[model samples]
Target chain A: MLKYNFSAGPCVLPQEVFKKAADAVLDFNDLSILEISHRSKDFVQVMEQAQSLAFEHLGLQDKGYKALFLGGGASMQFLMCAYNLLENKAAYLNTGTWSAKAIKEAKMFGEVIEVASSKDSNYNHIPKSYSVPSDVDYFHFQTNNTIFGTQLQETPSVEVPIVCDMSSDIFSRQRDFDKYDLIYAGAQKNMGPAGATLVVVKEEILGKVSRSIPSMLDYKVHISKDSMFNTPPVFPIYVSMLTMQWLKDNGGISWIEELNNKKAGLIYNEIDRNPLFEGFVTDKADRSKMNATFVLKDEAHKDAFDQLWKDAGINGLNGHRSVGGYRASMYNALSVEAVETLVSVMQELERKG
Target chain B: MLKYNFSAGPCVLPQEVFKKAADAVLDFNDLSILEISHRSKDFVQVMEQAQSLAFEHLGLQDKGYKALFLGGGASMQFLMCAYNLLENKAAYLNTGTWSAKAIKEAKMFGEVIEVASSKDSNYNHIPKSYSVPSDVDYFHFQTNNTIFGTQLQETPSVEVPIVCDMSSDIFSRQRDFDKYDLIYAGAQKNMGPAGATLVVVKEEILGKVSRSIPSMLDYKVHISKDSMFNTPPVFPIYVSMLTMQWLKDNGGISWIEELNNKKAGLIYNEIDRNPLFEGFVTDKADRSKMNATFVLKDEAHKDAFDQLWKDAGINGLNGHRSVGGYRASMYNALSVEAVETLVSVMQELERKG
Candidate 1:
């Protein structure tokens, strides 16, 4: 059976990306990618290409934003962001689990004022009309909630410098990339694998905190070293470069947004049309284009519905335990045909019911 | 040409490990290793197996050690070790660059007492006859210095808990594994690649510090989560596991220790015998079995010596700029045959000169 991976992350990347990555493992300029020095001319070129491509894809070229592919995942960024920027106070919008975690770390550095939170409804919708304090050091928010399947479609027009965690939905749609002072995303989503995290930060926003930051956690230290402060996650960054190249070769973020819209449209429309299933998010407008969470209306049909998707060659369709149902993650590499197969599975379950 | 990689990591792994890693990249249980979820049963097994192998190799099984494969490299551990263990003060033995770095981070948390330092002689030998202060929170030292090619031969008989950074030489030889409370090594050397860091820590020594540690930096939190607090560097860990398996299949640490000693002996003997070359370390007994540092007796023969090695397919033989000469890093996976090949190039240079 043909397989379609809907894993939330360390998720599906493009097939061509995998082929090139595997090839590099055997022979990248006559050296195994695993064995090459990060400072060697070849691997340095890879690091440079990855950073440049990140700038190109985000449309932040020559805009005083430095692109760094660092390790420790986006979770590290939650602490580092606060460690670097949280001087006296900061404002945050808590959408779900990740945001709450980010807020928890930020509070360790300084006072955190939550502008708004949607946790009351188990994060079923993105909170709107929140006000950021003018006196706070910066404003932070997560662009998409992977657990709750909600997304903030537009950037909040906050006057203070904005720090955004775009882990689940970065580069999947068009946006004014320059609005945020710092943007971080783990590579597992649409970029590459799980080892590296992409951090695009504006230079001016750093060096504001008075406390001494550890070398590994300080963004300015990494920026000065050009992301080679320590040995980087080389294989992950190289595969990420291939991925960014794939995105650009197939016409950048604008091109993928349309395909993603089509994919999200297919399954979400079926959920609305079929009587057996119900969407988990309370608001349709807040549904994430990357991950679609839903469940069967009748518990009696659960086993047959599970069998239908399993037999149809789908992987990672199970929702997070916090959201207890099914989640079909439609990332940049997930094709519309995969979504159609899922829809057919849902329809077959309804027919059986 | 058969190339021998001697880069001080992201360095050489076994060719068989590379082949298997490459194959898994294309397909690991019906999905790309890059695409699978870290929480999946298969990857969880990989994590469990890696942890168990680490314990088994260190001879610390059924002891108090918890093996964790973490991201951010050993640099992250520098701060984390201090944050979690340093309440009032710690004693650090300054052997070389890495030890100096670890000392710098420890100072951020509290007073750092330098028990001994070999910096006056440019770290040419490991300091001897120094007493670790019993009043200190812990005694810290690096087992191997890759840059200066020096190593501490035995665990110090310190009363306080010991913390170790074995980035370059972990699992390359046998030692009293239970003597230290914490041990960390970057995965690039001997293990696999550059993304993950292997941390083995005792559970009893934690929760003693008053400082509030960040979630990512706390080893206890990572241990509680089984190193899955968030997405891990999956590819690096998997490759590390395969390399550990390779080491075990060939008879574990004692077996590799004999091979490593032979490899070190061959090159060190050649460096001493050849009139054109000289070993860098001041004390022969302090020389590292992992990396052997040496220089040409006369600068005039540098070009000829360089060409001989390049012609013989030796890579990364150039020494670090801080100690300008040459370094032959013989990690666990590096064969004695490769060492013999390097020694032959040294002999060829002497003949040409």
Candidate 2:
């Protein structure tokens, strides 16, 4: 059943990407993907390509930027960032769970000064007008909140080096890639699968701290070794490199952003127009292009709406546990047609009323 | 050509396992394996089944043991153990590179007491007669040294809990699983690939430490979340599960261990008998059943040995950069026939000389 999958993470990859990835698994250059050593020249090329494409797609070439592929998720990055970068204090702008988690990790290393937060408003919007203190080590923020369906489309100017977690929205839009001192994204959304975490860092920002960073958590160590200090998640990184290739072949960031914007526009329009449905995030400007959350105006329509989508061969529409509604995550791999199919299901539910 | 792989890690997998894993990537239960939501019942089942099978295979059931599949390699685990388990001074028997790495990480969390070390002998053999300190939090050792090709054939009787980094040898042999408080393995070695790390911990041992472990490093948090604390290395975890199932279907560890012994014996005998080669580890008792290291009697034969292995369609035979000789890592998936092929190459090299 050729179902359109809307899984928020470990999510949908392009059909073509899947085809090649599968082929690689069986025989990647005559060595089964599982058989190839991470240290092999062929696999090292995969690592190099993954890193280079990451920087190139983000337009981060030769700007003192180095991209690294590592395992664990953004969750590990939360602590790793602090372990290597934090000195006396660091400032954070917390918008959602991931941002809050990052803030928690920073506290373990040094004093964490939270500049702003959106928790009081249920994280429906990205906190704006947050002050970045000059005295802090670095200013950290999540560019997008996956669960709350909001995004900071623009990187805020900070006196201290800017560190951003772009886990959910990395390749979905165009941005001034050089502004941030460090930017990291878990490869589950818009990039590749869930295993490899991508870190694009301005190299000069590292090794400023006095703490002895563990080899695994040290950004300097990973960058020095080209992310080969240990056996990397080869298959995931290989898949990510293939995904980056797909992104390149599909006309890079500007082309992808246009498609994503179109998909988000279609779904949001349906939610606002359909009398039976209402958008979860209150502000129209705050609605996420990646994860579009909406709920039925009447709980009575839930069953019919679910069944219609199920029949339409749709999957992973359930909202997060904290937010009980439907979330249609439109990553780079999701097509405008898939978004249209979801909108049609909503319209059908409204007509049934 | 169907070549045999002998890379230390991110190493070879069974051909049948490769075939199935490839098929799953394209379509798992009619859904793309890469596309499925981890929260979906299907993937949840995969996670649950993987954890349970790990405990079952280790004969750890009803032994207060919980299994976790986490991202990051054993290198990450080298820190994670200290974060959760190291409260005060911990005892360690440093055998080789991995054990030394683990010692380095443990020093970050608390005081570390080195019980013994084999570094004086360049890590060629495991140090014997190391005393376990009762005053320390726990006693730790590596079950197998991948680079040095040394194995601790018998578990030491420790007064404190035993923690083992079995990254290079897990599932290759039967062990007294209940004796250890914790056992960790990077899946790349004998299990699956280069991402998911397998951790089996005694539940009762946690919460005894006073330190606050970071969420990602917190075994309790991961155990509570069923190792889905983050997105997890889904592809790696899924592959490990498939490999575990393959292990069970192929008559489990006991059957695997017998074959491993045979392969090791064949290769080690060839190295000993061939006048051109000499075994690296003097003590047969200390030689790893999985990774067998050997060197030429003279370095002049290096080019010929390299070409002979290449012509025989073998891969990853070159030893680690630290110890430049040759290492044949016969993980569970590596066949005795492959080992025989390597041995035949050794014999041919001797004849040519």
Candidate 3:
């Protein structure tokens, strides 16, 4: 049962991180991680280290941006982002399901303008061009689509503030850390587990919206309280601290970005070169470096490709149910050697075809 | 340091559960618990077993009640309960800080009538007499108050519906589970860690609220999707399952209730007998069996008592900052011997006095 984990979110983490997490579970500094009080000096240090590490990894330190580790996942942020920032209006790019969901949540707070979209082509590409309005409070978009295998390559440079949900692609790439006004990601994809959500927000942008917000939902409250407004998901935050430290030791975001692209490039090259397979993304530039979605050239090869991967000790190669194909998620933990194994499988599939 | 954990929550769990959780983190059936996909067969089974165990422990199986494990803590449920159930009007009994906070959230949805309040006396006791109007849609009350160390001994017999927040005292004792339309707990105090929130709701009570509820906050959406409305707090839920299973093995709520009462009685007896200490609760019956709060007869003995508990290798016995005293939370996991050590410490303090 030793297999490469290809899950999109709640995916694989560094093996050393896993070991440390296990040890902490047994005894977090001699106190069981399960039993550590949230207010204890030991756990408070853990929380503070987790936040600083996240801010360091994101390169947001000393920039008036506070990184918060909250309990709910990215899904909760759909409504929370709007609750904190969507004052009179906002603009959102319709990239995929996450963007659309964000738009839906934002609509309740104010008028939201969909500047551009690629849904007409089943989201095979991230829209290249979009016009943001100056009247809108902020422009929001999803950085990577787990289901569609598309990603925004360029950060949208707009006059207004930019909000991004980097849930599926965070820590996989190094971008202008100071570019956006707000950024949130569910920790499951690249950071650690499914419980904690990482939120980095500029202090100045909050308290601008003309609406009463719940203390938990308000980013200002989280920032002011340093993300301990209430009891948080302690185990998830601890594991994530380990993972962030791993990223730091392993040359930070730029090095991981290079490694990620190397793996993704190998798989995409196989999809393009192989006769029996083709990339699902129409725009090669817009294709995700994290989630590589592709399909068999013909329907007849479905069973063979399926059995081939299963026999090769690959799991989670099946694509999302909404878009049926094969998706190989290449997060930071996925080794290039694993991608080479996948490339070898592609070569085998081609020969059989 | 090897010590007895007396933190309210994230409090101690069974030592066996801690060992099991650590093992699972290392290798959950050949897959690291962190790497297992939420949709994977093994994890799905884990989720299923967790929900069923919670319902069974509550004695609500096949009673049209669906148990849900979601990401947010009990604080989120304060708003979610009102968002789902508050229609025209609701009745609230404000016993302590938690009850008052629940009332604050419920007021945002509809009219809330405070049927009774013990806040006039700093919530030293649960109000014994209150007439719940038959016209209100649902009645909300907290089963146990952690900081104030008060508890509702009798379930409120309301005509419309009953909702309870069992965060601090769930699984410590058993009562008539059929009386309430909804019950929710943050799985940290008597349950497990501080990530997963357990909600058991009557299927028929939802969809009655007129306003739109966020998908993540809607109980019906979570119930229909089986709490997979999003990626759940996997590690916390897993540990909670292990704890609940341990409870079952050790003779469910009734046996734990007996053990809890013994520990509370020992501590209360010490408080009564020893001239150095006095109980905080005005009514003996209203005092929480789980969280036993008391104070030194004189603040002059503070250093001695503090040193005494520390010398006994106890942790988290300090009362909440809001209430400056000491609280020894005797949750299901705290052993009778631990309480015995505390009682001995109190006895030693009296001898010194």
Candidate 4:
């Protein structure tokens, strides 16, 4: 059965990437990819290609931006960003769970000003009217909220440097990549797999803080070594490189952005048209194209709806516990056909009613 | 021709583990291992089994020890240890590059007292005489030094808690696992591959530090969440679990330890007997069973020795720049036959000379 996986993270990746990654595991140049030294010429090529492809996709190649495929996920970046960048104060716009977590870690390094928040509405919408303080070290915000199903479609205009967490929506949309001084994304969603996080930072912005940073947490240390300061997560980075290649071969960000819009359109249109269902987020403009969250209007149709999706070979459609509803996370790898299938299931549920 | 891998780390893994890991990458539980959710029941079982097998091999199961498979490598633990445990001063034995790096990170959190150091001798051997201060937060030392090929056979008798970095030699030998309050190893060595790290910590020893610890850095937080604090390095952890299972199926540490000893004995004896080669470490007792460092008695034999090893299908025998010779790292997966092949190459060099 062809199952469409919609689990938030450690989520779906391209099938071709999986095949190539599997082959590499068994043998890559007469050596198992798992067994090669990270410092070896073969693995070095993998690292270099991965970094270059990341920049090429972002349209930030030959620019001041340095891309690192690091382990420890985006959560580690929460503290590492502060450890290296935050000096006295930083401004943060709290949109959802991840933003709040990033804010918590940043507070340990310096005074964190909450420029705005949408916690009162359980982060159903992105706050737009707040101003970031120019005197602050940097402005931090999440590009997309995975759990709450919200996204900031436009980058905020700020005088100071911008640090954006694009964990869920990176490479899935067209963005002014040069506008942000720093951008990070965990690979589980739109990029590759879990375990590696993609960090793109403008090198000039580092080394300004007075506090001595731990070698692993220091972006300067990693950038100087070309992201080989220590043994990297070899397979994750290779697979990510393969994924970036796949994206590039299929026509970079612009191509994926259009397909992603179509996927989002199919699902969101079903949620709005189906009298049996309702969208989770109150505002249409605040909706996340990556993850479509919705609930059935009539609870009596729940069992039929669940069976219909399962029968359609759908997986990971269950919503997070915090939000008692269904979530259809359509990452870059998720085809429009999968979204169409999901929409058909919803239609079947309404027809049964 | 069968190739013998002697690369320090991200090195050799069991062939069966590699095959299984490759299969899983393609499909595990009807989904790609890289694509499955970490919170899913299938992955949770894997995480649980991996943790249990680690304890079982260490002889620490049901003994108040929690094993965590985390990302960010052992270098991250260099700082995380101090963040979670170092409140006042910690005792360190600076044996080689890794120990010095650990000490450097620890100093950031609190006072680090180097009880002893072999660095003055260029770390050719482990220092025999060192008294750890009882007043310190913890007594820390590396079990196996990969660079210089030195191993501490005995657990340091300390009244304070003990923290050990067993990156190069975990699961290859038996020891009193309960003696150390904390143990961490990068998975690249004896475990599985690069990306994930194994951390075994005594439950009662945590939450003693007064400093505000980042959520990602806190051992207690990871313990609370069962090592799923965030999306873990899924493939790395899964492969580590597979490797652990492989070790257990083959009779665990005692079985591999004896094989490792025979392998070490074969190579070291050949190095000593051959007039062309000289062992790096003078003190036989201080020699590492995992990585055996050695050099040519005459630099004239360098090319000959290099060619001989390569002809015999040996790889990664080049020593680190700090130690300008050769380092044969015989981890758990390396067979005795591989060592015999290496020794035969040494014999061929002597015969030619």
Instruction: List candidate 3 stretches off by more than 4 Å.
Output: none
Per candidate, native contacts kept equal 0.78, 0.81, 0.71, 0.80
Q: Any runs in candidate 4 off by more than 4 Å, and if so which?
A: none
Going through the candidates in order, their DockQ values are 0.79, 0.78, 0.75, 0.78
lDDT of 4: 0.92
Docking class of 2: medium
lDDT pick, better of 1 and 3: 1
Worst 10 residues of 3 chain A by lDDT: A209-218
- Which is superior by DockQ, 1 or 4? 1
lDDT of 2 by residue, A38-85 (tens): 878899889888888998888889899889999998899999889888
For each candidate in the order shown, give its overall lDDT on alpha carbons: 0.93, 0.88, 0.88, 0.92
**lDDT per residue as tens, model 3, A1-353:** 56787888788888999889888877777788888888888889988998888888788899988888988799899999898888898999998988888888888888999999888988888887668988899999998999999988888788999889999999899888699989999999899988999989988888987777776687887777778888989999999989989999989998999999899889999999998888889999999999999988798999988888878888789998877889999999999988998899989988888
- Cα lDDT for residue A99, model 1? 96
Ranking by lDDT: 1, 4, 3, 2
**For residues B193-288, could you state the per-residue lDDT of candidate 4 as single tens digits?**
999999999999998888888999999999999999988898999999999999999998999999999999998898888888898987899999
Question: Which candidate number maximizes DockQ?
Answer: 1
